[model samples]
Target: MSKKNLQARDISWLSFNARVLQEANDPTVPLKQRIRFLGIHSNNLDEFFRVRVATLRRMIELGGKKGNMHLEDNPQAILDQIQMTVLQQQNEFNRIWEDILKQLNKEKVYLTNEQNLNKEQQEFVKNFFDESVRANIIPLLIESLPQLPYLRDKSIYLGVVMRKTASAYDQKYSLIEIPSKVVGRFVQLPSPPGEHHIILLEDVIRFNLPYIFSYFGYDHFDAHIFKVTKDAEIDIDNDVSTSFVQKIEKGLKNRRKGKPVRFLYDKEMDAGLLEYLIRRLNLSRRDNIIPGGRIHNFRHFMDFPDVFKAQKKERVPFTHPDLQKAQRVTEVILQKDVMLHLPYHSFGSVIDLLREAAMDPDVTTIKITAYRLAPASRVINALINAARNGKEVVVMLELRARFDEENNLEWKEVLEEEGVKVLIGVANLKVHAKLCVIKKKQGTRIIQYGFVSTGNLNEKTARVYADHCLLTSNRSVMADINRIFKYLENPKTTIQHLRNCNTLLVCPNAMRKRLIAMIDREIKTAKTKKTAKIYIKLNSLSDELLINKLYEAATAGVELNIIVRSIFCPKTDQRRFKQPIHAVSIIDEYLEHARVLIFHNGGKEKMYISSADWMVRNLDHRIEAAVPILQPAIQKELKDIINIQLADNVKARWLDDELSNNYVISGDEKKIRSQIETYQYLYQKTGKHSEASSH
Candidate 1:
C-alpha cells in the first residue's frame, strides 16, 4: 500500500458505483427505495461515462496516456477495467430488476407491454398515447435520410425496424424519441380493482407503430430502447477576442454535439439496427457500446408512481432548534453562531435570512456565491428582491457547473436584468465556495452575518443532501469572507488579499498548505507518543500530495478516520503502517455531502467544515473555503454526527483494499442507522429548546 500504487481514479469511481449497485441488491431496503437505488446507479454510471470515461477516451485518441501526469492509470488499462466492471454491474442490475419485478407481482402490480394488454387496458393505452404522447414524439426514418438526426443525449429512443409482410428487403428503419420529459414515461392503464397495471411509454408507442407509419403500410415491426451518452465536458478556450459568457455559450452548443462516449441499447434489439447505429455513429469498441435490459433510462424510475403500499414509516425533517421560532434569522446569528444540518434541519432559515435582508431597510449590502440552484429558486427570488430594494447585491454565480450550465446561464440573465451585479469569477477556477455575507447599518455601526455551507444553496437538493451551514456574526470570519470576495472581484490585483485572510482557509494556494501543515503537526505529535488523531469526511480524496501526507501520518501511528462518498484513492490497509485507518462510506436516504476535518492537536481539538474536498482540482483549481468551528457547541455537534457515522454498522461499508463493499455488521450490538439516529438526536433537542424559550 504505497501511495504511489494508489487506485486509478476511474477504477475507484467504478468501485464507488458498485456500492450503489449493492444498495439496489440489498433485500433489507424497501422495495421502492431499492428500485430508486437502481435508477441512481444507472444515472451515476451515465454521468461517469460522459465525464470520466470520456476524458480517458480523449486522452487515448490524442496518442497514448504518456504526457498527462494527472492520469492515475493508463487510459487503455482504465478503459478496459471500466468495461469489465460495468458489464458485471449491469448483470447484477438486471438480476435486481427481475427480483424487484417479481416482488411487485406479489403485491399485485404488473408492468405490461403492448402484447400483454387486455381489451380495456389496450384501449386505455392507445387513447393515452393519442392524447398525450403522439403530439410530443417525432419518428425519424433512420436509413432513408442522408444523415441521422442528432440524438439527444440521455433521452431514450425506440429503434424501429418495419417490414412489409411479403418482402423482407422492403424494410424501413426509424427512431422514435420517447417523450418522457413532456408526456411521462410510466402510464397507468385500466385494470381490475385489486390489481394495478402500468405500461411504459415506449411500449405504448410500439403498440401504435403501424398507425404511425400508415403511409408506408408496414405490417411487421420490431422496436427496442436505445440511448446515447455524449461527452459532457465543456471546453472553454482562452481566447481573448471572445467574452467569457460568449465562450460558455459556444461551449454549451459544442457539448450537445460532443463525441459519443457510450451507446446503450436493449439486448433484444435487432442485430441489423444495432450495427446500422454503430456504423452511422462511427463508433469503435472504445465507444463503450453496452447491451442492457429493455429499459435504456432507468433514471426516470426515480420518479416511479407511488402505487405500492407503504412498507415503512416515512421520516420527516424537523426545524433546527436555533431557528425554530426565531423572530429573525439575522438576529439569531448576530447573537450566536447557529449551525444548520441540512435535511434533518429545514432550509427555511437560509431563505428567511435572505428575505429579512431583502426587506430590511438598514441592510446595505449582500454578497453570495451560487454553484447550483433549484428551479424557481427562492434563493434567487430573495436575491432579486434584495436588489430591487436598493441594496448592493452581488452574486458570483458559476455558470460552469456541469449539467447545470444552461440553467445557471438563464439565472445569470435574470439576475443581471434585475440590476444585481454578477461576477462570473476567475476563469479556470470555478467559484465553488458556498458563502453569503450580508451587511447592515445600525446608528453609524456596521454589522455583518450570513451562512457558509458545504452544499449548494439549492432549496431542492437541500431537502436530500446532508450538509452543514454555519450562520454566524464572527467578525474575523466576516472579514475573511469579504477578503475572498474582494480577491474574486479583482484576482489579478488583489490575490494577496486572500493570502492575508487569518480566519478562513481560502483555496487555490492557501487551504492545501494549511491542511498539510496541520497533518504534519499530527505526525509530529504521534511520534512524541502524545494523543493524535485525524478524522475527515469528504466527497472525495484523490490529491496525491494529501494522500501521501495521510499515509505518512498513518505510518507515524496517528489514528485516522475517513468517510469519503466517492473516488477514494488511498491504501488504508497497508500492513507496514502502524495502525489501520477506519474508512467507511454510507449511502443512505440522505446523501452524505458534508466535508469536515478534525485534528486532535495533542489536547486542543480543531475542526473545520470545508467547501472543498481533498481532490486536486478543488484545492488547486477552484475557489473553495474552509472555516474553523469556533463555537464549542457547534464543534461538539459536528463531532457527535461524525462519531455516530463512525459507529454506524447498518449502512456503512468498509473502504477496504478489496472494495468488496461489505457492510459493517452489527453482530450482538445495537443497530444504528446514522441518518435516522441523527435526525432523532437533533429533533428531540428542538422540543427542549421550545420549552426553555416559553419559560
Candidate 2:
C-alpha cells in the first residue's frame, strides 16, 4: 500500500472521536469521569461538523466530484458514513448512559423523568418549573407560522405534539426550546427518604404540559427532545468599509442562521413527527440526521453539579513542583531558564510574572498576544494594571478565535477602556502565538524577559492542558520577537531586521523552509549511516506538503516518531517507510496541547518548542513562533518528557496506516501513563514533596 491511499482527514477525525467514545465505555474509568468523557466526545463532534464537515459540504456543492479528490466519494457519501458511525456511537453512548444511571442509583442518586417520579418529587418539580422555567418558555405554533422558526445551533428543543380529541387526525405540532441558557437543563428535585433525585428541565415541562396549554383546551400532549447543529463557520464579507471588529460581530450573528449541517433527534420519536421536522426544516439525508438518546447537548456535563459527595469526583491534582519550588518567578527565570509544564505546573507562575511586571518601576512596556482567554482572565487584568501604572502595554487580541470571539471582544473593550493599546490581529491571519515580552530597564540597560507558550494564556485551561512555556532572555530571540511585534503593529512596515533571525522560526516567513531543511538534514545524516531520528509532538498533522516531506525523510531511513493528539493524515505502509514512522496519540485526563520538535543533527541534537502545528493553517495563515531550546538542561528535560510519552502504553493509542486507533498494548510490562509519569519526573527534579503523596 502507498501513502496516497490514506483516509480523508475528516474520516480520520471521526476515528479519533470513536476512541473518545471507547473511553466513555471503558469500565476501568471512574463513573463520573466517564460521563465527562461523553461530554468531550460530543463537544468534539460538534466542532468537527461546524468546521471540517461543513467545509467539505461547501466544497461538494461548489465543485461536485471534481473538487475534492482527497475524498474518494462525494460529500453526501461522506456524510452518510459519518451518520452511520454516529448512529452506532449514539447507541453505545446510550448504553453507557444506562450503565452510568444504574451506577448513580447504586450510589443513591436517581435521575427521574415525569413518568417515573414519585409524588413528592413530582410536586417539587412542578413548583420549581413554575418558579424558574415557565416564565422563560416561548412556544411556537407550527401550523400558524408563515415559515418555520430558525432554531439556534446546538441547543435542545422539545418537539411537542398536541392532539385534539374531536378529530384523531388533527394534531397540532409546536416547538419550545428548553431555556437551558437561562435555566439550567437539570433541575434538582426533592429527595425521597435517603435517595437524592434530579430531573431534566424537559421533564419538568413534560409534567406541566396540561397547564402550558390549558387555555387552548388541549389535553393530549407528547414532547420529544431534538436538537439542530447548524454550520458555525463564520463567513466574513469582503466589505472594505466595515471594520474588522464590526465584520466579526456581524459574522457571529450570521453564524446563528448558517446552513443546517446536522439534525439529532430522539431514537423513539414518531416517524410522522420526524418527517414533519425534516420537511419543515428543509433537511435532507445528507444533512447528517443522527438518532440520539433522549437528551441532547451533553456538553453541559462539563459543569455537571457535584451534588453527590466530594469523593465521587476525581482527586485534586497537586501543583507542579517546578513552579511551586520557585521562590520568585522572575528571579528564578533570570537565574535559569525555567520550563513550566501546565496542568502539572500551576499557571500561577505566569500570572505571578505578569503581576511583578505590572508593579515593577523599571518595567517600561508589556507586549503579549491573546488568542483564547478565560472569561475572568488574570492575564488581561495584569496587562490592564500595567497600562494604568504608566507603562506601555500592547495586546494583540485575536477576535476570530472560533468560539471565543465574544469573550475576546469583551476583554478588548475592557482593555481599551483601561488605556491599553489593542491590536485586533493581522488582516487575514490569526495571531495564535502565545507570547509575552516585558521590557525593563536595569541601570541603563534595557532587559527583555518573557515567555512563549504552546497553549493559550487562559489560566482556566492551563489547569487542564499539557503545555510548555519557555521563559527566556536570549538576545537574538528577543530581538527577533521585538521585530515580529513591530510587524504586527504595522503590517506595511518592511521587516528587514528579521532577516537575521536564526534562533527563532517565524511562520508565514521561514518556519516551513526551516522545518523542511531540518528534516532534510536528518535524511542526509541517515543516508551517511549515522544515527538519525526525529520526534515531534503536535496537536495536528494534516498538511500534505509536510507529510510528504516527512515520508521522503522516512524513505531516506530517518527514524520518525510522532505524538499527535488529533487529526493525523499520514499513511506509513510502504516498505520504504515501513515501521520507521510510528504515530501514537495520548488521550489522558489533561489535554495534550504542546508542540515540541526534536531533531537528531548527527550528534548535536536540536530541539524547538513551537506555537505552530504541522498544519497549513498554523504555518501559512497564522502568526506563529517556534523558539529553539538553547539551554542544555531544558533541552534534556524536554527530551526526557517526550521519551516518557513514547514509552507510554497505558493511555497511548497507535495511529496505524488504516487509521484504526489501536491502543498500544503492554503485555505484562509495567504500565506507564505519560502525564502522571511526567509529573513524577518533574517532582523528582524539582525536589518538592514526596511523589507517593502527590500521586
- Number of the top TM-score candidate: 1
Task: Tell me, by lDDT, which candidate is best.
Answer: 1
User: Could you tell me every candidate's TM-score relative to the true structure?
Assistant: 0.97, 0.95
Q: Which ten residues in a row have the lowest lDDT in candidate 1?
A: 686-695
lDDT at 651, model 2:
85
Measured by C-alpha RMSD in angstroms, how accurate is candidate 2?
2.4
Error of 2 at 58 (Å): 0.6
> Can you list the residue pairs that collide in candidate 1?
none
Q: Estimate the TM-score for candidate 2.
A: 0.95
lDDT of 2 by residue, 1-695 (tens): 34455556777788888888877777777667778888999899888888877887887776655532344346666767777777777887889889888888897988788999878877887788789989999888887889889898868889988888888887888899999889987777778677778888888998988889888887798799998888887888889999999999999999998888889898888778899999988998768888877888898876666666554323234554545656667777666677787776678878899999999999999999999887788998899889999999999999999988988899899999999999998777888888888899989789898988899999998888889989877777778888878888987666554455667898888999999999999989888888889999998898878898888888888889899998888887677773458889998778899999999998789999999998878888888999899888889989999999999988899988776778998899998988778877876665654434212
Alpha-carbon shift of residue 613 in model 2 (angstroms): 1.4
Which parts of model 2 have CA positions greater than 4 angstroms off?
A: 1-3, 64-77, 308-327, 495-500, 689-695
Error of 1 at 460 (Å): 0.7
Off by over 4 Å in 1: 1-4, 64-69, 688-695
